[model samples]
Target: MSTGKGPVGIITGALSGIGAATALEFARLGASLILADIETQSGDEMITKAAELGGTATVAECDVTDYAAVERLVARTTADLGRLDFLVANAGIAEQSRIASGDPARWARVVQTNLLGTMHCVRAALPVMRRQGEGHVLIVGSTSGREPYVGEPSYLASKYGVVGFAYALRMECAEYGVRATVVEPGTVDTPLTRRPPAVRALLEQMHPLAPEDVARALVFTYQQPPHVVISELVIRPLDEAVNADMPDAEPR
Candidate 1:
């Protein structure tokens, strides 16, 4: 920890995209952070940047898809920081193919990273939070979770699971002073979204939400009074019409 004076937090997938943005945002708040991800170089870069922003941070090389790895990351955070105040289950992957032609292997990776990965992080953190009698868990879901679309079948399934998982986790942990929030962002301009050529083409026409936009929402949700929980937050770009068409469908 860089000795910053704020609650300690662990952000999964903290090296890039929305996760990176969220880490930077929290750093601006002087929060202590465990930037968890599989990318070491990016993590180091983020740590240096975080220090520049007046935040204390360290990188934890973690593969969120592995339950044991996630458990260890949670344990390590509390040991090094002395307390665990918040966790952002933000690690995820996306596939652009439809169910009929999509590779099952890719779909499996998507579910493991997006859905089970969230579950592992939350489950490991809950006990720690309950012991302290306070904590917050923020799961980054996609707008795809709430609506149907032509493509991205696996991604949709995973995110939908995330939404339900967050709600159920909220109910289970609220009494213990732990909070769970699901953040669903519509179209965001991130590497994941830009990877698909079709989505990249659409990005040229509309001003999609930036990664920082969703990061701000996460910070806002996390900074709320402990007693108040913003259960769900859905954000989309103004030009991203609701229930539009395949790919741009529903700001997902």
Candidate 2:
């Protein structure tokens, strides 16, 4: 857990699921964190947990969908921590609907949060990282980005955009010593994944990966040497059936 000289990082959507788990994992390694989320109560809880781990943490109430809010979050992190070592663009949302039946409003929300939100974070954080001459950006993509599913066309499109952006960003940031990685996790059993009972039941039967499992993959990427970038990682539960036809779960 003691990653000597731990990094200073920001994790979006740190109130629950993969974001929360990743924050705790980073705390366990003694990293200083800025947990950004709209959920104040849960954000406070995460701060307390980080303290318990002997790590420093602060909560930033940020709605990633808001560019100004996301900008302020990054600004605050640098102002407080003096340097931004990493950014985890893990804040996302999902809804289940077919392309033909999906609500336009819902689709817009999904695109904003899952795609544009990540873009904002990357845009805001890269300059700070460039100034520091080193940093890492971890984009939390999903398996849906890689393959098609039964429902949720909008969600799939957003993730696909994220995956594409992550790679392009990686190349763009390499010269500045900033690393970018996209983590595509399949069937993670988190609050985000448990919204629909039908999809949840199907996932449970397959023993979905835990939030902690995905967190581990993230931490592994962060711990690597600056010269090495694990550009993209696809993690799925053992025995998970890829392309299984199940009801679409929530977007995030």
Candidate 3:
């Protein structure tokens, strides 16, 4: 798993939640990090934490919805770090609304951030990985992508799109030594998931998966031999049903 030189990678949505946890885990592994997020204050805090962990890290104020911004992020990371080793397309958001009653704008935003945003990161990073002839791309997906849920049509669509994209990207990148993987985690306890009281309560009862749990999974995927590619991984907390009844719950 050791790269003679420290591994360098970019993680989108690194300000908090799974993204932040992944950055910290990479730091502990002695990886050079490019943490990208739109939130300036939180991004700075993460940068400080990465430094405290003795890991080299820089913050990129990036909005994944902006392809140009994502391009610059990849360019800056490679220009400064000397190599691009991994890309984690983890920038995502969720809204609670039904297709029949949901806000059109909100649904669109979800699609843009979760689906289009991931595509932008992949498009930006694939070239660098191809050039290097070795790289890993981890797309943070959700259980909703694999199974249908009750609410949040947009979020579901977006995640489903991510899963589909990962599969296609993996095939396309196979010849170039770039591994594409989709890590689907279920009911992770994070600020994003805690917003809904009912959903949060249900997750708490299920002993929901922590952000670190998913982060560790990412690290494992990255640490594997270059010749081995884990195409898709679905992780969930024990005793937690994949798509439990959530009559009142919304998408996340």
Candidate 4:
């Protein structure tokens, strides 16, 4: 697959961070990619960069929170690229406020984008993959899902919801020859992680996992043989303090 035009896949939130890093890694393997995001300028820029790396890529302005937009993104990929081999549901947001005093609106955004957004991408793409008799769905989750932490009520809830959804999805897609895998990563240096000052300090103090680190793991999971189903993967920095100090921190 790396020798020529590779797997046809769509990556939500492909403009930056882990999403962008993943896109470039896939490009190095010569994959055909649909860089999906709400941003157009960065999408265009990523397309150029992917082509420079010898991958065929295009941009789709998609809001994963909107099911209709997600459906259209899947449709466009199949219509324009011939088939959908994989779906990377990586679009997400982070929140750092306590539920008792936090903005409900922000909480809603976190849940909608992190959890519902993943569901939208999977729902829109799974049917196409089922018809194809082969496909992969890789969701970018977080360490927050695996354990409870302070100051990240909604974000953790959403990720935990995603972990549940991925396992159930794996069962449903098993008979259809489609695979579902959720990658949970610890702190990563990304735009999303840098949003809040407290999280930013935590990020700066430690040697957190880079976006490319998570991206490589994602590609390896997808590149596995058809029969191999890597149900779940969790990656964290070697430093135990990352978890001990800021347990609520996550990767986007």
Which of the numbered candidates is closest to the native, going by highest lDDT? Answer: 1
What's the residue-level lDDT of 19 in candidate 4?
96
Model-by-model lDDT, in order? Answer: 0.89, 0.89, 0.87, 0.88
Kindly state the number of residue pairs that clash in model 3. 0
Task: Please give the lDDT score at residue 197 for candidate 4.
Answer: 78
Ranking by lDDT: 1, 2, 4, 3
RMSD of 4: 3.4
| Candidate 4 per-residue lDDT over residues 74-130, each given as its tens digit | 998888788999899999988787656788999999999999999999999999999
Full-model lDDT, candidate 2: 0.89
Question: In candidate 1, which residue ranges exceed 4 Å CA deviation?
Answer: 2-4, 248-252
Off by over 4 Å in 3: 1-4, 247-252
Error of 3 at 21 (Å): 0.5
User: What's the number of clashes in each of the models?
Assistant: 1, 4, 0, 0
Worst 10 residues of 4 by lDDT: 243-252
Q: Which ten residues in a row have the lowest lDDT in candidate 3?
A: 243-252
TM-score of each: 0.95, 0.95, 0.94, 0.94
Best by TM-score: 1
Which residue window of length 10 is worst by lDDT in model 1? Answer: 243-252
